[model samples]
Target: MISVKNLYHSYNKDGKYQVKDVSFEVANGEVFGFLGPSGAGKSTALNILTGLLPLQQGEVVVGGYDLKKVSNERFNKIGMSFEQSNVYSKLTAKENLDFYRKLFDVPTLDSHALLKLVGLEGKEHVKAGEFSKGMKHRLTFARSMINNPEMWFLDEPTTGLDPSIAADIKDIIKEKNKEGVTVFLTTHNMFIADELCDRVAFIVDGEIKLIDSPKNLKLQYGDKLVEVEYMEKGEVIKTTLSTVLPEDKRELQKIIEHHDIQTMHTKEATLEEIFIKVTGRGLV
Candidate 1:
């Protein structure tokens, strides 16, 4: 649904780029993640794709229209939710969505349904200025869907939200994706990426380090080890045994036969571990 090639963006006349030599593609119904830390240029790339920032160099295309000469009509097919909430403070939650609904030429989702979907059903009449940060964030998220967009650009959609609310947001994203919305998610949260993304790109210092499915990346970089917690001399002993070694397998067999096993599970590399391995830096 989206394609970018040799994308580069510089913030100043000196030509120091924030996004350099970036390239990737998002399939028609795929949820693609751009993973990185703060100032790693995830947002810079996203801003350029969404037309928030001017195209500095290279090519970008969304929904088959060249970004360089894309029309306003093309924008109607896209929706965006930034990390920071942008809502009309004086307007009520319903009013906020109702206002955005008029901006699109396409049909819009119901404002009441959107507010309820984001867990703000009763706050429809409350002025946005009185809302907490998380409340406003939810409102902004709902507004993004006002156009029933085909492609969704989300930057840290669940950041700063409590666990329950974050889960709700994630469920909503999943539901939208199931309905064929293509997602371009930019986030430092590995768990969100791992759960929602079909494939992820590890980006650092404005360049992409790697791109693959989370399952494939883990299989490539994860260790073949089994973690065991067992009773040894009245104490709970926790250890890992390599699954690829014969000696380790014998040791595990002996433990299961002679020792009381408390817990056992395979240990695999997490997305963050793989990211660190690829980029030489943590997501944070």
Candidate 2:
């Protein structure tokens, strides 16, 4: 749904750079994540793709229209949610929804249901200024869906959300994906990326080090051991057996077959681990 190649951006002609030769793609109906730290050019890259900032070099295309030459008609194909809340604090939640109620030409959306879906059902009567950070985030999320575009650009989507609230936001994103919305998400939170992104690109200093599915990266960098845990004689016992080691398969089979296993799980390198190993830096 979105494509970028050899993308580069800089703030000034005196050699201050924000994005450099960055490239990636987000396919239709897929959730593609961009993981990077602050000042790492994530927002710069996002601006270029979203037609906010002029492209310094290379090409960007979104929703079958070249972003560099996109028309207003193409906007219906894209939607965006920014990090900061832009809602009017004096406006009630329903009033906020009512504000953008007709921004699109499609059938008017049922904002009451939308607010309920985001967990602000009864709170719609309250003005946004009185909301906590988490509440504001949820309301902001509801605003993003006002257009029902084909693609979404979410930056730090779960910022200010508690675990439960974050999960609710994640579910809303997943629900949008199920409805065939392509997502180009920019976030530093690897946990959220691991759970929601079909594939992620690790970017630093405006350059992309690697892009791949989390599961595949884990397989590529992790040992093939299944860690087992159990309790015996009031003490915890643990053991590791090669899940992919043919020679140890028999032993693993015997252990599972003969002993009381409390829990067993395969070991795999996390996206954060793989990113640090490749870039020698953390997102923070």
Candidate 3:
């Protein structure tokens, strides 16, 4: 549903480019993530894809139309939810979605049903201005689905949300993907990306440093050792063993047989740790 090749964009002539030779593709029904820290050009890339910014260099096609030549009809197939909530403050939750439903000029789900999808069913009568931050975020997510868009663009969809709300949002995203909606998610939250994305691209300093499934990246960068923790004497003791060595297996067997085990698990690298290893910088 989306494709880009050698994409590049700059804010001003002779100024540094915000996106540099970035390239990727999002297949229909795929949950693709653009993972990066602040100042990593993630938003810049998303803006170009959504036609919010002019495409200055490289080709981008979203939903079968070239971005530079994207028409209103083509844009109607896309949905966007930004990190910052953009609902009308004075409008009630139902009123807000109703307005956008008309803007799309297409058959849409009932406003109440939309609200219910995002866990705002009974709060439909509440004015957005009176809603809490997390509630407003939920409303914004509902608004994005007003038109039942074929391609969804979510930027930090769960930012500032409590754990329960975040989980609800993630479940909604999964539900959409199950129905064949292509999702392009941009966020620095490694755990979310790992849980939801089919594949992820890691961007840093305006360049893509890595692109792979979360599981693959972890195995590629993780250590090949398992750590065993046990209670020895009056204190807890920990030891590392090579996962592939026969001697290490014997040592672990001895520990398991003689010690009161507390915990034993493989030492796997997290996405954040792998990001740091590849880019030599932490997420800001």
lDDT of 2 by residue, 2-49 (tens): 889999888884566788888888899999999988888888898778
Candidate order by decreasing TM-score: 1, 3, 2
lDDT (C-alpha) at residue 49 in model 3: 94
Q: In angstroms, how far off is 212's CA in candidate 3?
A: 0.8
List the pairs of residues colliding in candidate 2: none
TM-score of each: 0.98, 0.91, 0.95
Clashing pairs in 1: none
Best candidate, TM-score: 1
Compute the lDDT of residue 170 as modeled in candidate 3: 98
Q: Which ten residues in a row have the lowest lDDT in candidate 3?
A: 67-76
Steric clash count of candidate 1: 0
Off by over 4 Å in 3: none
For model 3, residues 1-284, the per-residue Cα lDDT tens digits are 89999999898846689999999988999999999998899999999999899999999999999987858887678899989998999999999998888887678879999888888989988999999999999999988888889999999999899999999999999999999999999999999999999999999988999899988998898767888999988899989998879999899889999999999989887888998998898887
lDDT of each: 0.94, 0.85, 0.91
Sort the candidates on lDDT, descending order: 1, 3, 2
Which lDDT tens digits does candidate 1 get at residues 51-143? Answer: 999887999999877989958888789999989999999999999999889889999999999999999999999999999999999999999
TM-score of 3: 0.95
In angstroms, give how far residue 129 of model 2 lies from its true place: 0.9
